[model samples]
Target chain A: GDKVKQSPSALSLQEGTNSALRCNFSIAATTVQWFLQNPRGSLMNLFYLVPGTKENGRLKSAFDSKESYSTLHIRDAQLEDSGTYFCAAEAPGGSAKLIFGEGTKLTVSS
Target chain B: EAAVTQSPRNKVTVTGGNVTLSCRQTNSHNYMYWYRQDTGHGLRLIHYSYGAGNLQIGDVPDGYKATRTTQEDFFLLLELASPSQTSLYFCASSDRDTQYFGPGTRLLVL
Candidate 1:
């Protein structure tokens, strides 16, 4: 079985639009992290959460450990937001390992 | 800014050949990790180290060996490469829950 699963494998949004990406965890995740892999193939860390919500600029993320899920919301999407978004979860205990989802490929066009 | 760098950004090897991927982080973080990303499996952890000379196996550690010679350097070794081992490898350093990633190394085994 898949430990972490992401929905809406691919998405397309118009400039200034908004969309959301979701991740479901089958493992007992203690924390979650979000990242964006840009077109140039560089991974940029977005957020690291421990069961709550955090907003930065036009991006907001929420993680619910009890419910075992996480969501990343993009507001006022721009051309620079076009990339693959990935969510990773760290299981309970002292493990630093992160189980990742396949990712959501996003395209924001003008 | 926390900088994590991986050397030999791209590599090509034949079956039974040897390969090594190197990573260095300047943030002085205590944790470092190695992961492989495939189309369907996303990013699967291969190995991690909490500090110098400490190695911990992840979910997909078979056929891969890692060494952390210092607080800043971590290396992943493939003694006998195979076609199935071809993928994009990432190195990351962490400060608690937040992890910063490297540019990644693309390996191809023929």
Candidate 2:
């Protein structure tokens, strides 16, 4: 079984549309971080949450430690946003080590 | 912003060869990590260190060795490479909260 399981393994979005990706953690996660791996093979940090919600531009992310889940919401998507989104969770009593989910492949088309 | 860089962005080697991938972070982060990404498995941790001269085994550390020589530099070594080790490798640096990833190194073992 996976410690961090991501939902909607694949997603397609039209330009200017919105979508959400989710991750469920079997481990008791204390924090969550979201990353977008672009076509050029560069991973960019989107948000880092600690049991709350964060909004940056058209992207928002929420982490609920009590429920052991996290969600990333994207609004007004663009073609440049097409990439693989990964969610990583940090468990309690660890030294900043993270367990990653399988990730959600997102394709934003025009 | 944290700046993490990896050398030899692309590499090709024969089986049973020796290879070393290097990573350096400009920011003074305390934690550094190494990960591999494949087609089916999104990403798996190989090794990590909280500081210089400290190493921690990760989920998939069978064929990997990592070392944190300094606060700014970390390296992943493959003493005997295998075809199964062909994958994209990433290095990350964190400050016990948000993590920043490098551009990644692509290795192909023949």
Candidate 3:
């Protein structure tokens, strides 16, 4: 059984459209982080949440510890947003270790 | 933004060979982690440390050794490389709240 499960293994979106990626945790997650792996293989942290919502630029993320899930929303997608998005959850008893989902590969077309 | 850097951005080794991946963070974070990413697994934690001279086992700690010698440096060692160990490795640092990742190191074992 997977500790973290992601939805929509892949997604394709048009530029200026909106889409959301999700992660469900079977563990008692205390926090969640979202990362975007670019085409060049660089993984960048996009959001770190603690059971709440955060918005930066056109990206918004929410983590619900009680519900054991997290979501990352991208608004007005751009061509540069074509990449793989991963959500990682930190369990309550872990030593700062994160369990990651399989990731959602996103392709934004012009 | 936190700055995390990895050395030998790419690596190649043969079976039973030895290799090491280096990571450094300038953010003065207390926790550091090493993770390996595969095609379907996304990312799995290999090891983590709370501070220098401290090590903690992660979910997938087998076949991997990690050491934290200083607050700014963490290293992952592969004493007996195998083809199954070929994947992208990532290093991350966290202030106990948010984690930032470094540029990944791609390893190929023949």
Candidate 4:
């Protein structure tokens, strides 16, 4: 069984549209983080949360530790947003190491 | 700004060869981790270190070895490489709740 699972392994969105990504954790996660891996293979951190919500520009993320789930919402998709999105979770009893999901490939077209 | 860099961005080797991937972090973080990413399978932890000279086995450690020579450098070694070991390798460093990733190393075993 996977500790963290991401939904919609792949997604396509038209520019200016809105979309959301979800991550479900089988372990008792204490914290969660979201990242976007660009085509060049560099991963950029999007959000780090602890059972709460955070918003930056057009992206919003929420983590529910009790439910062991997290969500990333994107608004006004742009071409630059086309990349692979990954969600990682940190279990309660473990060191700050993370368990990552397979990732969702997102493509935004005009 | 925190930065983690991986050397030999792309590598190609024949079966049963030896390969080494290097990672360096300028963030002065205490925890470093090595992970591999494969399509349809999320990132799997290969090894990690809490500090210099401290190595710990991760979820997938068979056929792989890791060394933390210094506080800022961590290296992953693949001995007797096989095609199954061909994947994108990423190095990460964490300070508290946020984990920063380096540009991945793409390895191909023929």
Candidate 5:
């Protein structure tokens, strides 16, 4: 039983297309964070949510604690967006440790 | 401009050898974490510390030891490396919110 499950293990998109990645948490998650791991393996934090939604640039993220799920949306994808996207959640009963999903590898082509 | 830097971006060692991965954060964050990324498992926490001289065990603590000597530095030590230990190690710093990650270190145990 995975505490955190991610959808669409992999994705391929056109440069200007849009896509959404999701994560479902079986545990009672209080906080959720999204990250992008580039091809060189550097991880960049995209958003940290405590319920509700947040947007930056062309990316938007939403976390619903009651639903135990989170979503990351990319509008107008770019070549730089081609990477593995991961969502991690911190459970209310856990020891402040984060449980990460298996990640969604995204490939953007021109 | 918070930065979390990991040393020895890449390393190769023989089995039974000892390896030390170093992490330093200039953000003066209170929490520091060590994680390993495998093929299927996106990122698994190995160890973490709230501050200097305070160490906490993570989900996968076996075969790994960690030390937080100062607020700016945290280190992960492997007394006896194995092939299974080969993975991309990431160090992160946080203050109960967004986590800033390092570029990650790729380790190969022969």
Candidate 6:
């Protein structure tokens, strides 16, 4: 079984719409980070959360260490938002490496 | 600008061949990591380093070895390459709690 399980493995939305992605962890994570892998296969950092919430432009993310879960909300989705969204969790005891989920492939259609 | 660079941009090798993927970071971060991305599985860490001359095993380190020769240079080596090792590789450097990723290296094993 995967320590970090992402829900809605694949999602589709229309431009200007909105959607949310979630990650459930069983690793007793201490921190969480979200990234968007664009079409060019480049991973871009979206949010770094430590048991709290953060907002950037139309993207917002929240992480709950105690609950071992995190969420990413995308508003006013654009075509450029179409990519694979990945969530990684940092456990307390390891060498401070990240455990990533399988990821959610998001497709934004115009 | 903060950046992580990897090379070669693309590679192809036969089974039992040797391959080395290189990474460089200009952010002057203390932590560096190597990861591979596949279709279903997003990204899995292969190796990491706290600083120069330090190496740490990641979740999926088998068949892979890594060395951090300098603060800005980290290298991943495949002693005996196999078809299963073909995938996109990414290097990352983390400062504070945020991680910056490289453009990625695409490897094909035959």
- Scored against the true structure, residue B66 in model 1 reaches a CA lDDT of 100
Off by over 4 Å in 2: none
Q: DockQ: which is higher, 1 or 6?
A: 1
Tens digit per residue, CA lDDT, model 6, A10-106 = 9999999999999999989989999999888989999888899999999999998878899999999999999999999998875678889999999
lDDT of 3 by residue, A1-110 (tens): 48999989999999999999999999999989998999998888898889899999999999999899999999999999999999988888856778899999999999
State which candidate, 4 or 5, has the greater lDDT.
Answer: 5
Q: Model 2, residue B40: what's the lDDT?
A: 72
How good is the docking of model 6, by CAPRI class? Answer: high
Question: What local distance difference test score does each model get?
Answer: 0.94, 0.93, 0.93, 0.92, 0.94, 0.93
Which pairs of residues collide in model 5? Answer: none
True contacts kept of 2: 0.78
Where does the lowest 10-residue lDDT sum fall in candidate 6 chain B? B91-100
TM-score preference between candidates 2 and 4, better one: 2
**Individual DockQ of the candidates?**
0.86, 0.84, 0.85, 0.79, 0.87, 0.85
Q: Which candidate would rank higher by DockQ, 4 or 5? A: 5
Q: List, residue by residue over A1-110, the lDDT tens digit for candidate 5.
A: 38999999999999999999999999999999999999988899999899999999999999999999999999999999999999999978646678899999999999
**Any runs in candidate 3 off by more than 4 Å, and if so which?**
none
DockQ of candidate 4 (2 decimals): 0.79
Indicate the TM-score of model 2.
0.97
lDDT of 4 by residue, A9-107 (tens): 999999999999999999999999999999887888999998999999999999988888999999999999999999999877767778889899999
Residues A59-87 of candidate 2 have per-residue lDDT tens digits of 99999999999999999999999999999
Report candidate 3's fraction of native contacts.
Answer: 0.89
Look at candidate 2 and tell me the lDDT of residue A107: 96
Give the per-residue lDDT of model 3 (tens digit) for B1-110: 99999998999999999999999999999999999988888888899999999999988888999999999999999999999999999999998877889998999999
Task: Quote the lDDT for A1 in model 1.
Answer: 42
For all predicted structures, in order, the TM-scores are: 0.98, 0.97, 0.96, 0.96, 0.97, 0.97
